[model samples]
Target: MTNNLPLTVKRSIELLGLIGLIAVMVIARDIIMPILMAFFISIVLLPIYRFLRNRKVPETLSIVLPILLVAVFVALIVWFFSHQIGILVKDFPQIKENVKQHIDSLSDWISRITNFDDKQQKAFIQDKSDDIMNMATSLAGGAALTLSGVFVFIGLLPIYIYLMLFYKDILLRFVFMWFKADDHPKVKEAIYETESIIKSYLIGLLIQITYMTILLGGILLLIGIKHALLIGVIFAILNLIPYVGALIGNLIGVLLTLTSSQELWPVVTVLGVIALVQFLDNNILMPRIVGSKVKINALFAILGVFIGGSIAGVSGMFLALPIVAVLKIIFDRTTMFKQWGILFGDERPAKSPMSFAKFRRKRNVEVKPGSEKG
Candidate 1:
C-alpha cells in the first residue's frame, strides 16, 4: 500500500525512521552499546573460534578461550598504563617546577610584548582559577561515573561475545529468514562482506596501534623526550578516531611534552616528530595495512564520529567507521537505499553529468565553435 506514496513522502518516512532509530540508540545506549561491541568483536575473533572448533574443541571451550585471551590482552594494556602513570606521578615535583618556569617565562614575554604586566596576568589567572577548579571537579565526577559504567560494560562484554559465537548459526538463520529465498544470495553476500570488513578493520587497527606505539615511542625516546612510551600509547589509542583523533593526539602529545620539560626545543622536537610519524601513518601505514575497499568520505565520517561520540562516548567514536561500512554494505544491497550507499562512499565520477566531456561522449562528436545553436 505504501509503495504508491509520493517520492517526497517516501523520503520523509525514511528520514523519520532514521531519527527514530537514533533516538532508540541514545535511549538504550547503556544496553545496546555492549551488544554492538560484542558483535564486532565476535567477528574479529571468528577465525580463532573456527580454528579451535576444527581442532575438536568444545563449543563452550572455543568461545571461552578466545574471550580469556582478549581479557588478558586488555589487562596487560591496563597494567602498562598504570605503570607509566605511576612513573609520571613520581616525577610530579619536577613537572611542577617545569610548569612554574614555563609560566614565568610566558608571563615575562606577554609583559614585554603587550601592556599587560605580570601583576595583571596573575590577577586574571586567580580570577579564572575558581571556575577552572569547578570544571575540573565536574569532569572528575563524570569520569568516576563513566568508570563504573565501563566496568559493567566490560563484565557483560565477554558473556555477549560467548553467546554470539555459540549461537552463530542461529543468528545466521535469523538473518536468512528476514529475506525471501530469491534474495538469500545477496543477503549472504552482505553478511560475508560485513564479516570480512569488520575482521580486517579490527585486526588492522591492532597492528596499527602496535606499530604506532613502537614508532612514535622509539623516535621520541631517541630524541630524549620524557614519558615517550606513555605519549606513544596515548596517541596510538586516540588516533583510532578518524580525523579528529590525530588532532587530539597532537594536542595531548604537546601538553605532555610541556609538562615534562622547561626547554622549548624539546616541545618543538616532540611536535616535529609526531608530525613526521603521523605523515607516515596516514600515507603509508594505514592504506597498506587497512585496505581502502570500504572507504568512507571525510564529510560523513566526521559527522559519524561526532554523532557516535555524542550518543555513546569514546566507544561510539571508535566504532563509527565500521558501523558506517556495515550500513553501506546493507544499503548497497537494498533497492530502496542504494542512493545512501553512494552518499557514504568515497568514489568520484570521472566527469560531471552536464560536463562538456560527458555531453560530447553522449553525442559521439565534439561541437566546433561555430556549431552552436543560435
Candidate 2:
C-alpha cells in the first residue's frame, strides 16, 4: 500500500513515524531506561556468563556470580566516595574561608574596574546568594524524589540482566521471527556486531575511568590539591557524557581546586592537566581501545547527547553514542534507512559536489562556450 504512494508522502510518513517514536521514548523513559541500560550491561557481561556456562557451572550461579561481582565493585566505589567526602567535610571551615577570600578579591577587582562600590557589589551578591539558596532548597526536595527513583531503577537492573541472559535464546528467536529465513544471516551479523561493539565500548570506558582517576588524581595529589581523588572520580564519571562532559568536569575540577586552596596556581594547573589528558584520550586512547567500530560523526553525536538528555537525562546522555551506533548498524542493514546510516557515520566522500575540481570544471564549461561564441 505504501509503495502506491508518492515519494513525498512516503517520506512524510517516515518522518512522522520517527517523531512518534521519539514521543513514545520520552513518555516512557522511566520504564525503558533501566531495561535499555541492563541490556547493554548484559552484553558486556556475556563473556563471563558464557565462560562460566562453558565450565559446566549451574545456570543460576553463572548469572548470579557476575551480578555479585558487579554489586561488590559498585559497593567499593561508594565506599571510596563516602570516605573521600568525609575527609572533605572536615575541611569545611577552611574551604568557607577560601571561598570568602576569593569572593572578596573578585569584588575588589570589579570595583576597581567599574564605578560600583563594594557596598553595591555586596548587595548584588547578597541578592544572588538568596536566590541560589532558594534554588538549592528546591533542588534538595527534588533530589529526594530522584533518589527514590534511582533506587527502584537500580533494583530492577540485575533482574532484567538475569532474565535477558537466561532467556537469550528466546530473544534471538523473537528477533529472527521478525524477518524471513532468507535475512537471518544479516540479522545474525548485526547481532554479533552489536555485541562486539557494546563489549568493547563499555570495557573501554572502564579502562578509561581507571586510568583517568590514576592520572588526574595522582598528579593533583602530588601538587597538594585537597580531595584530589574525589575530583578525579567525579571527572572520570562525568566525562562519559561526550563533548559537554569534559567541560563540566573541568569546571568542577577548577572549583574543587579553588575551594581546597587559596592560591590560583592550582586552578590553572588543574585546567592544564585536564586539557592535556583530554587531548591524549581523544587522539590516542579512544582510537586504539574503543576503535572505529561505532564511527559516529560529531554532529550527530552531540545531537544525540542533547536529544537523549531531553528524553532521559544523564543516563541517556552517557548512552547516546552507543545507541546511535546501534541505530546506525540497523539502518545500514535495512533497505529503507541506509541514508540515515550514512548520515550518522563518520565516512567522508573522496570528492564532494562542491569540491575544487567540480568548481573548476563548471568554470571551464562556461569559458569553453564563450570562446566558441567569440
Candidate 3:
C-alpha cells in the first residue's frame, strides 16, 4: 500500500516523519542522551562481558564486573583531572596578576592607536560592567543546569549499562521479531556487522586518545609550554567528536596558551603543533586504526555532529558518529534504505591513467600467454 503511493507523496510522508523524529529527540534529549551513551558503552564492553560469560562466570557477576571496571576507570580520570584543576585553582593569584599585566599592555596598545585616554576607557567599562554582571548571573544559572544534567547523566549511565547487558538477549529477540525466520540470516549478519563496526570504532577511538595525548603533550612540553599535558589531554578527548571537536580543541588549546603565557609565539607554536598532529591523525593514523569499518564521509559526519549537537548538546555531538555509523551499517543491509547507505558511505570513483587500448592490450597479452599454456 505504501509502495503504491506516488513518489512525491511518499517523500512528503518521509519528510514529515523526519521532522517528527527530530522533534521527539529534542524534547526528550535529557532522557535520551544517557541511554544512548550507555548503549554505545555497552557495545564497547560487550566483549569483556562475553569473555566472563565464556569462563562460566555468573550472569550477574559478568554484568556487574564490567560496569565496576568502567566506573573505576572513570573515577581515576576524574580524580586525575580534579588534581590538575586544584593546581590550576592554586595558581589563580598568579594568573590574576598575569591578566592584569596583559590588560595593561593591551590598554597601552589601544591608547597608542585610539585617542581614548585611560580615564575614558575606565568610564566605558563602568558603563558596561552592569551588563557584564547580568550576563554572568545568567551564565551561573546555565552552569547550575548543566551541572544537574551531568549528575543525572553520570548517575544513570551505569544503571543503563547494567540493564542493557543483562537484557541483551531480550533486546536481540526484540530485533529478531521485526523480521521472519527467512530473513534471520540477513538480520543476524547486519547485527554482527553493526557490532563489529561499533566495537572497532570505539576501540580505535581509545587508541587515538592515548597516542594523541602522548604526542601532543610531549611535543608541547618539549617546546616549554605550560599545562602542556592538560592541553594535550583536552584536545585528544575533544577530537573524538569528529570534525567539530577538532576545531573546538584548537580554540581551547589556544585559550590555554594565551592564559598561561604573555608571549604570542607560544600560541602560534601550539596551533602549528596541533595542526601537524591533526594532519597526521587524519591522513595516516585514523585510516589505519579505524580501517574501512565505519566509512562515513565528511559531509554527513559534519552534518550529523551539528544535528546531534542541536538535538542534545555535547552528549549528542559525542554520540553522533557511532549512531550514524550503526545506522549506515543497518541501512546498507536493508533493501529500502540502500540509497541512504550509499550517501553515508565513502566509496570513491576508481580512476586509472592507463588508456583503454593500453589496458586491453595488457589484458589480452596476459590472456594470450595463459591460452597458449592451456
Candidate 4:
C-alpha cells in the first residue's frame, strides 16, 4: 500500500485538474456564448447564401440581399406598429382606467366568494396594485430599450453575416486546414451536419411562426378583436420562446380583451384560438419540422432554455436549441466526444427479440436449420 501511494497521488492530481478545467469553462461561458451564437446564426443563414450562389448571384450580392430583405421587413413592421404604439402611449390614462376597472370587477367577484367586504377587498388590491403597476411600467420601459437594442444589433448583424457568407469557403478551408490532410473528410462531415441542423431549425421555425400568426390573427379578427394583427404578430414572435410564450401571449390577450370589450365571448374566443394554435404547434408543426431535425428531449430542452436565459436572457433562450444541435453534431462526429453525443441524442438502443437462431443469423454464424445440439 505504501509503495502504491505515488500512483494514487497522481490520480488524485489528475481528477483535480479535470475539475479545474470544468470550472474555468463555466466561468468563461459568458465570453464564449455570444461568439457561439453568432456562429450558429451564420450557419442558419448559409443555405440562403447557397441558394443565391446556385442561381449565379455574386457572393457579395447574395449575402447583402438576404440581410437587406430582413432589414426591410423589420422596418416595415416597425413602421406599421409605430402608430399602434403611439396610440397606446398617448391613451395611457384611458388604458389605466380600463385596467383598474377590470381589476375592481375581479376583486369584487373574488371578495364575494372569500366573504371579504368591499372595503377590505379595495385595501388588498390597493396594496398590490402599486407593485403591479410599477412592474408593468418597468417592463414597458425595458421593452422599449430592448427594441432599440434589437435595431442596433440588427444593424451590426449584417456586417458579421456578410463576412461569414462571403468568406464561408475560406473559413471552411481554414477550419479543415487546422487538422491534418487525412482529417479533412471528418471535418467536412461535421460542417455539413452542423449546417444542415441549423438550416432545418431556422426554416422550420419561420414556417411555424408564419402559419400560427395567420391562423391566430384570422381567428381573432373573426371574433371582432380590436388589434387582431398586432396581437397575432406579438404572439407569433413570442411563440419562438417555447413553452412559456403561448401562456404569456394568452394572458396579454385576455387582459387586452377584458379591458377593450365588455363581451365575455370575445375573451373566450381569444383563449380558444390560442389553445388551438398551441395544440397545432405541439402536435403538428413541431413534429413535422423541428422535431425531426433538432431532436432534443423535453428535459434537456427546458434545461437549455434556462441556461440560455441565464447567460444571455431572451437571445440566449432563442439560440439554445440550435446551439445544442450543432454541438450534438460535432460531438457525434468525434471519437473523443461520442459519449456526449449519446447523452444529447434522442435515439434509443435497438432492441432485438430473444431467439438464439435469429441472433446467430444476425451474427452471420451459419448453423444447420434443424440442429438441436448445443
For model 4 the TM-score comes to: 0.77
Q: How many residue pairs clash in each candidate?
A: 0, 0, 0, 0
RMSD of each: 5.8, 6.9, 7.0, 8.0
Report the lDDT tens digits of candidate 3 across residue range 236-353. 9999998888988999998777778887899999999999999899878988888776677789999999999999888898888988998888877766566677668665323332
**Candidate 3 or 4, higher lDDT?**
3
Off by over 4 Å in 1: 354-374
The total number of steric clashes, by the backbone 3 Å criterion, in model 4 comes to: 0
The estimated TM-scores of all candidates read 0.93, 0.93, 0.88, 0.77
User: lDDT by residue for model 2 over 187-233, one digit each (tens)?
Assistant: 99999999999998999999999988998888888978788899989
lDDT scores of the candidates, listed in order? 0.89, 0.88, 0.84, 0.72
Off by over 4 Å in 3: 124-129, 348-374
* Per-residue lDDT over 161-248 for candidate 1, one digit per residue giving the tens place of the 0 to 100 score: 9999989999999999988999999999999999999988999999999999999999999878999999999999999999889999
Query: Can you give the lDDT of residue 29 in candidate 3?
Result: 92
Candidate achieving higher lDDT, 1 or 3 = 1
lDDT of 4 by residue, 182-251 (tens): 8788888888777777877877887877888789988888868867777787888788876666677888
As a whole number from 0 to 100, the lDDT of residue 181 in candidate 2 is 97
lDDT score at residue 197, model 3, on the 0-100 scale: 83
